[model samples]
Target chain A: MPRPQPEPVQVVKQRRDAALKAMVEGVPYVQWLGISFDRRGDELTAILSYDEKLIGNPLLPAIHGGVTAAFLEVTAIVELGWSMIWDEVEAKKLEPEDLTAGALRLPKTIDFTVDYLRSGLPRDAYARARVNRLGRRYASVHVEAWQDNRSRLFAQATGHFLMPQRDG
Target chain B: MEDRKATLARQFIEAIPHARALGMDLTELGEGLAEIVMPYADHLVGDPSTGVIHGGAVSTLMDTCCGAAVMSHPSIPAATATIDLRIDYMRAATPGQSLRARAECYHRTRSVAFVRAVAHDDDAERPVATATGAFTIETNGGAT
Candidate 1:
């Protein structure tokens, strides 16, 4: 298929904007998984709500590990914006709205690995992330999620996301 | 279902390194559903700042849970990969509490399966987080 007339950059910008907004409103997966979102500047934080549905037993209910990965992905996407993905002269910066319209998109994950620690219970789960270092070819970031002042960790991950080139 | 549960328990024991590292016990397992828990230890708590548990640590446990559940099925025969996963925070685990997770495979077709899981810290009555995810079950026959 011939490339669409709209600048390739526009494609990304539109998608980027949509992604940003969805990041704010949360996705169906979030609702299904019971994950929530909170944002500040370029930073994003995931908030897990405490409830009966989340518990597995007394003192040791299973913490949904997928939610851990999802939170990290969200933080990474938001952090990507501040990183080198935006540095390309030809790359068009996208707003939260652009992604909502559906310009940018994510690919099927090839593989992911995670290391888990203290499992936090229902009541307090929080994780923060930063882009850290990034390049035109790719970006890398680190994230940490914690629960309570006690800081029982539930999950962590290291992975990659696709970034197709866009026209300036 | 009984056969499936036995298969899940065997797989859980085989898939997760921590199940042994943390001395995990198989609480329960069934068709499209399973629950596992591990003895709590101070070392699992990796966060120095908050003196609580680290998020990545919890995620790892759940990842294995998902992988084990999907891989245990006889029909599907490939390693599973996650598209992405997100978790919300509610409260910290009790200092001496163990971690438990209930995982369920909702929809399954050739190569992809939709899953949901919930984690609790010592109190199954109240969950710390609920998780839903997509797993690409890399089948040998391109079943999907």
Candidate 2:
């Protein structure tokens, strides 16, 4: 009749660390986008370096709107994939190599919404995603992207992703 | 003049940095409609097990197609920018098949254009994803 206790901090940290490692090393598309994670603090930040190939407008020299959207989406996916903890049995059995080689499935997106607040300049950008809700089969994340000044945001996105089955 | 419009559309699409990166090709252009294609590449795969294309790639395709539609509108603007966009993924796109996006700018005001688009692989009825977006219409030396 009592609620189950939450996972211990150490165990949770270990799983989270493993997930992040897999996200960076295992995913080739993430590498193509030049996305990296900054996990020095409590929050994980997605970083997009300025690339000439990401420009959408030659006139304004602006980053492509779609590229910005893609960057935000990838950020949300990374946030969700890196924080998900597997079941106890699977967690115990997972090795670093297993985690790297598709031990867990990537979350599939159901819907994605992006708002362009300002034109993205041709510069490095940073984004962060926070999970609003995490159900057993679904998760919703809100993400924001900024360049130079955080207050002067470039774009924001909200996404719903279908989570992988935990026990299967 | 029609040929000029087609040339302009192609130039505009090719000028986009992300479109070039994704190897997007402007396949068709009309008064308010545009179609673009993105070939499948291993680097674009999201689910390695299934070899399915990433959702972001689909989003990029739709977004680029939508912008192209806006640019090809009869009352073309000097410049346009995306205001907002929403995409719903219906299903995963079949791997190794190029994705095609068809977009239409259904309505336009003095400063805004509304567009809707769908991305599909082989089956036209079964779309991989769909999108709706608003774009800003900016004129040179004119009101926004």
Candidate 3:
């Protein structure tokens, strides 16, 4: 069988962008959880629309811990994909077939830790991630989710993801 | 008394929206242990390239299992909430297998309970993920 050829640089970039857009707009799990994204300059925010399906404690009527954890993790991945982009010049030097050949690539979670500071009420929630560091093979992110006010945190998480390598 | 406790515990698990959405089933409940299962569904896939189940689904299973353990503990309280949880993913779960989670509440205090859990598909020895969590109890007159 003939070996598969690497896609052109422009094609790779387009593929990466489409993947990210699908993640934010129509991914199955993300859409089920009602997650949306807004990117402004360098800041990316994940929004979780309120629904009865998110409530864990019916009495307190609070959101589920697992749901909140997933929200934070997704926010981290989304931010990493959009914020850690390589310039066109750098992409030109990398391996044509490398996984991170273009500006962004998918990330796999190595570890996820979440702290539940307060009960998440049955209301819309927002989350944002800060990339602590983005290395060639790994990245670390800190994410926080809040409802009503940013000062009032519903949950916070720190995640480490394994990234695909690319040449300098 | 055990039957009543088990029934209450199942009720608590069924009340949660995410658990209900995932169709979690409570197979067993004891003083401080719980076993739950999540059936495979195509919509649960996280990666489009690979049809394997999402890590979040496993996390939800473990969390719900741990919560059931806390609810069924001997020193049951009126209400409980997760304080913190740390999950380590050993590997991606197989695409078409039903994942099961078993959790145990190791200890309990006046205001907190400690729980540990593992999620596995077919092989009991190899876990897809494991987690440890702390839950805060409502305590005292608050015991429901």
Individual DockQ of the candidates?
Answer: 0.06, 0.70, 0.47
Model 3: lDDT equals 0.80
True contacts kept of each: 0.06, 0.75, 0.63
Per-residue C-alpha lDDT of model 3 across residues B16-130, encoded as one tens digit per residue:
8779899888888888999999998877777756677767777788888998888878876767788998888888888889999999999998889999999999878889999
Each candidate structure's TM-score, on Cα atoms with residue i matched to residue i, is 0.45, 0.90, 0.85
Q: What tens-digit string does per-residue lDDT give for candidate 1 at A63-141?
A: 4444455556555554564343334323445554444522333221222344455454556577676655455445556
State which docking tier applies to candidate 3: acceptable
lDDT for model 2, please. Answer: 0.85
RMSD of 3: 6.7
Q: Candidate 2 vs candidate 3: which has greater lDDT? A: 2
For this target, which candidate reaches the highest lDDT against the unseen true structure? 2
- lDDT (Cα, tens digit) per residue for candidate 2, span B48-72: 7678877888888888999889888
* DockQ-derived CAPRI band for the predicted complex in model 1: incorrect
Model 2 DockQ reads 0.70
For model 1, residues B10-79, the per-residue Cα lDDT tens digits are: 6556544335544566667555666777556655543222345444445645655665566555454466
